[model samples]
Target: MSLNKETIRVMNVNIYCEYNISEKPPLILIHGYLSSTYTFHRIMSKLSENYSVIAIDLPGFGRSEKSKSFRYSFENYAQLIKEVMDYFHITRVTLVGHSMGGQVSLNVAKFYPEKVSKLILLNSSGYLKRANQLLILSSYLPFFHRYVHYHINKHDVKEELKKVLFNHSLITDEMMEEYKRPLLEKDFPHSLIRLLRHREGDLSSQDLNQIYTPALLIWGKQDEVVPFKVGQKLASELPNANLIAYDQAGHLITEEKPVEVVEQILKFA
Candidate 1:
């Protein structure tokens, strides 16, 4: 069965989410940085046939209202997600996060392991080595930001969108529009700024080994944002974790190969 989308207001933030209940265990799909619940549209529809699926737009993205005053750290986002789960009376869930969302899932698994049944990280950030820190910082500057944003405006947004995507070709005009339309809203930029400022990917090796959750990690072999080696690192650290690498895809594995991604998720579930 297909899930009907819904929205709920919590702490003055509008959270856009879709909930579909079936007999099987519920799945919570979390999108990556600057992404909305729409990222999981295809997967949700397919998985809902047997398993319940709940996909939400994190605060400051998609239909979720950005709280400019709040600090947008991954830890805070995980707390907000915990609150959302409590609001729905959902005790146990399998969290499947893509990119930034994967990082958030790791935070949740760390802080509230009781609530998470399983963890899935797809092209996730947070396992970067010491050497890559400098390169990531360079992209945070205003000059580069303006250059990137300018190109996004000049080329139907898809041109700039492709940069963050692992599989650039899958970033179609339609996908670009879906991702861009909400970003044009007045508060989006500030929210994005807060997200960047608060992003910290310094998870300790000790902590990584502590996550005993059944985890599945997927990475695009050509992922430019989080290298394939990072996935290998994550798989090594996480106990009972399996890693899958997609050779032809980029960072946006969900968009590039939705069918295979969903199939892998089902097998893991």
Candidate 2:
């Protein structure tokens, strides 16, 4: 299935997205930190078969504009998502968020419950504090953004993918190219510095408890970034949540196990 790619202006920012229409409530796919709609390419087609699928590149990531002035907090991100839904005339949706996106989805459900019918999180980041004082403090320095850019740009894409995927064979030329695209943008480094300074910590247990929306938490047992233990803790905290763990997967569960992820989504959402 071919997706319609478009860039919509919201809150003075150009938000990039790929979508396919369907009668069912839309499935909003939100990628993790430093990721984009490309992260969901593997599962979007199959998911579109059952529900309208909309995958977006959050501000400062992917094809989206890297605005130094845009607020990067999870609360603002949730609000931006709601505005996107309104732009498409969508009332309610099933939110499918991976990693950092998962935390954003939770904020949406917490603050705008009426807009979300279901929540699906894959290897979601949880119970984490904001950046360390030293990093946050250093972001105040004039040239810190350059240092941030240099640090990330120096890493080999293949090595980075290996750390996220349990199966190294899945790393490919296309994946590397897509992952590296944003780094080449001139404004990316500055935007990333703002994101690092503006991002808030994940919601606390009390906040998680208040979100009663039915949720499905999917975790990769081998995930090194956000381990399976986090999923177990989330399932226990969330009022209506169930977790499913995949032994062979890792941080990139959506890419590593698209079929299984789709199957579970069809079953739960």
Candidate 3:
């Protein structure tokens, strides 16, 4: 399928954000790590009718290409997003992020609380960083990325990808194709490495008591990436946050349970 209509001029990055521009209460959708705005395709279609759904493929992912040596830390990602929002003249908007995207969204909320009207994190990563330290250390290993390069052609990374998605049965063949298509393009893996290495851990935890923006935390009962129990700690820490756990779901809660997610977001938004 051609993704022609999903184009949007945001900052210097001509990002891929899909939405019905006429709708009210603009909402921005952010995808997880190693993923793209395509993750929200189905959700956006259903939401665009009543709300302006803007799903962006972050600077290093999907359609937006960054120059060589661009650092992909959570702070930089948050800044890029802020620039995009500013370019569009968005004052107060609802921010929804999944996994790594959730980390970025929370940082945006903490740093630019005035700009974000509400924060929605779907199985976010900030709640647990020590657990991800092993991946961070491995990404820094000498020639570790070479394995990723060699495996890309061998088509052996599906298992790792499955781990990220929590081995969900809802991951259809078509969805797998969509997830893997971007990696087929040259230079995608290098960008992925850059993002993984530079990402700063959860900024929300530094001063969790400061966040006054009404926040909603959603997680899957079976989420392997960020366990459901972590959401309880986050809810307890974030000043005004609430948690909603979806039974029988995995890491990709919004993707796996779009209706429930949309309903909760609408209630909070």
Candidate 4:
């Protein structure tokens, strides 16, 4: 159950990851925005027992390298996942993505269908609810930029961490520190701004129609980030998909309901 961590160079960038190779097609874990693979710690070891599991810190997050020059688009993120897969010579996989990672996973299935066999989305963010015009605009002004920077740096990430799940008591000092790590990284702020600036509406119903891969949607009914209603609509739109909602949980279904999430993932796969 111990995950072996490694750093491998890909396209001149060093990518950090923890993985275990077992069977042919592996279960790949993709973390959300401002998050590292550490969030998946609760479920990875158990799943790794029966399936080849790989969880990584996408570039600019976690232990991965960050560079202002790198593109932060969903396509770019998906391509990075492909690079990792190719590095391991893994051709087919079942992708498990959370929030922003879900958006990347959808793109991967849309553009690289052959590489994905099944998908598991935990409160995925393919559907953009509404845009914060002020925030996006503020990212441009120097004064506002520094203001935003200070806000991000000083914000008690634990407050938001509490929102990610239903129970605030579950928030741990270790988890708080892990989520705060990227904010301290030099280039992470710029990349975060870039991602926010590029934030667009959700994929159109027509656009989602193109993803024919079977998918499992695990959502928390109280999810504030991406509502359970979004998950319901997504399930209806995906050609082959089903959704499971936990009433007491919030956005962080994996952390809020790890056993349920892992059970559904294993059952679906």
Number of the predicted model whose TM-score against the real structure is largest: 2
TM-score of each prediction: 0.86, 0.98, 0.85, 0.92
In model 2, the worst 10-residue window by lDDT is 19-28
Clashing pairs for predicted structure model 1, backbone only: 166-250, 166-251, 167-250
Off by over 4 Å in 4: 129-145, 197-201
RMSD of each: 3.8, 0.9, 3.4, 2.0
Better of 2 and 4 by lDDT: 2
| Per-residue lDDT of model 2, residues 155-267, tens digit only | 99889989999999998899999999899898999888888888899999999999999999999999999999999999999999999999989999988999999999999
Cα lDDT tens digits, model 4, 171-257, are 998988888877887677776777767655567788789899999999999998888888999999999999889989998888889
Highest-lDDT candidate: 2
Error at 66, model 2, angstroms: 0.3
Clashes of 4: 0
1 versus 4: better lDDT goes to: 4
The order of the candidates by lDDT, greatest first, is: 2, 4, 1, 3
Backbone clash count, each prediction separately? 3, 0, 0, 0
Please report, in order, the local distance difference test score of every candidate based on alpha carbons: 0.80, 0.93, 0.75, 0.84
The digit string of per-residue lDDT tens for model 3 on 176-222 reads 77777777766776776776678665764646778888889999888
Please give the distance, in angstroms, between residue 253's alpha carbon in candidate 2 and its true position after superposition: 0.8
Residue 103, candidate 2: how far off, in angstroms?
0.6
Range of the 10 consecutive residues with the lowest summed lDDT in candidate 4: 142-151
Per-residue alpha-carbon lDDT of model 1 for 155-259, expressed as tens digits?
556765676666565666678779888767766766766666676664667888999999999888988888888899889998779999988788878777789
Clashing pairs in 4: none
